[model samples]
Target: MTSAAAVASPATVRPSRGLAVFWIVAGLFGVATSFLLYLEYVGQLTGADPIVSCSFSPIVTCGPNLLSPGGNLLGFSNSIIGVVLFWGPVYAGVSSLAAPGGMRRWYWRVYSLFIAGAFLFVHFLAYRSVFEYGSLCPWCMTVWLATIPLFWFTVSWTLREGVWGTGAGTRRVGAAVYSWALLLTVLDYAVIAIAAQLRLDVIGSLF
Candidate 1:
């Protein structure tokens, strides 16, 4: 017979419930889009004519855009990469949600590194699609949109909460991120969107 107080309590981290919720929503959205992209990619590989429903225009076709050389740079569809890559955040988010207790210091650090890689790779692929492929996969763009916030806030929270390490510089930067994360994220997207307009003139070309 075990006493009621004998069982150990579950551990919890210090990050806010809001942060966990943010991780969950953002992670799930990215994963869902990535999964959709993967399905589209698979359809193309299998020679399916009706690959996806959103390919009614030249600049927004999922099939041709994904079948381009850039999509297979790794000898496979980049969406596959996205399917795998977005899971990092998904898992982290789930963990945070289930157990709001903060994760280990090193966990945040490692996540930051992984997201950094993902952030860079996404831009690389985006550039290839924009300039070389002359099109954009809507699903890919969704992943890009989700990833920006994921990376921004992940880094921001890690620094602000001193999850990785404690230091004056880290705290100072973290404070800045906490204050300006949303504005910076919006600005970052705005700059890229503006640049894309300059080169692609998406609206101008559409009309």
Candidate 2:
């Protein structure tokens, strides 16, 4: 019984640590991204272009991006959403470390689902900003980039916890789903980067 318990303990403890690390890294990046967005938001409110003030210059302008229709998703600024979504995960990750037994499995599962929903929403907004708005908010893109790791790590952690299931069939299907999501995200970013580059080139050529 002692040996059996020891084996099971490793499985639970090791994965939890790994998941905690994932959330910590994601939270740190999210916090940094939020700070940048806050600066830009402050600049917009005060009638100054923060990106230009920061020396990003002609190629990147937070002002235009913030003013775009996509920036006000559902009538609220995107940074506001980032603040709510990111701070929760950051708090959760930190609290887990300090508390006894850390966070529970169900807590992680529910939190992961919440973050997943946010990720989907943000991805949609990102697509609109890139394809329809025709501008990239550097701060917004940073949030998007940070969100990827948050989503990926959460999903990975959930899988390792066997929250979905432990059967071979379940594992196979889960792996496939994760792989497809990752592939789609990569393809989407690649297309957006290529399109943005082309747009910039065209504008440059005209001048």
Candidate 3:
């Protein structure tokens, strides 16, 4: 029978510095973008002008989305959620860098779950913004931009590290997917871009 120490020290892949750096950059970008949106929301509450820096036109602005019912779907500004949760990636990256021995499988599993939820939520917001509001929110788009990669990379890394499974086949599949994480992220961006263009004529509005 395997000893307790052996069972606890199962061989597994560790997160690399590159992945850590990506998380840090993406997290910071998300935090900054969300904070800007939150400040805009605060401005609106103070009876300030609706037309803010990110507002370019009626079809391509954040003002309506910010004031709309969907903006406060959870009884407060969605940007506040973004500002608060974006730090998770930053903290994970810092921890990985500080302790290169790597985190436990359970920790990564929970983190991946959090990122998955964020991925779905951002896309849902995107759909509502395009179909319901018929507007393109620049700050919200930035949040989506940051989240897309964060989701893909975190999933990929967790897979490669055996957080999902430790079997040889599982790790192989994880390695394959990890190598394509960037392409997957780009494809995701393309899907959102296509949807936005079809519904809102985003390109035409910009020109």
Candidate with the greatest lDDT versus the true structure: 3
Q: Can you tell me which runs of candidate 1 are displaced by over 4 Å?
A: 1-13, 47-52
Among all candidates shown, the one with the greatest TM-score? 3
Q: Which of the predicted structures, 1 or 2, would earn the higher lDDT when compared with the native? A: 1
Better of 1 and 3 by TM-score: 3
Off by over 4 Å in 3: 1-8, 11-13, 49-52
lDDT scores for all predictions? 0.70, 0.62, 0.82
Q: What's the distance in Å from true for residue 53, model 2?
A: 4.3
Estimate, for each residue in 1-207, the C-alpha lDDT of model 1 and write its tens digit.
011111112221345656666776777788778778888787777866544564646776677668787777788887777767777776876775565345666776888888877777778877877777777677888888988877777777777666656687896797777667778779877876776677677666556
Over the full model, what C-alpha lDDT does candidate 1 score relative to the true structure? Answer: 0.70
The TM-score measured for candidate 1 stands at 0.84
- Tens-digit lDDT track for model 3 on 1-207? 011111235643357777887788899999999999998888777867643488776678888888888889899999999999999999988887787566777888888999999999999989999898999888899999999988887887676667888788886777777778889999999998898899989888877
For 129-172, candidate 2 gives per-residue lDDT tens digits of 65666666677777877787567656654564455556676656
- TM-score-based ranking, best first? 3, 1, 2
Clashing pairs in 3: none
lDDT of 3 at 65: 89
For each of the candidates, the C-alpha root-mean-square deviation to the true structure, in angstroms, is 6.6, 5.4, 5.1
Assess the local accuracy of residue 19 in candidate 1 as a C-alpha lDDT between 0 and 100: 62
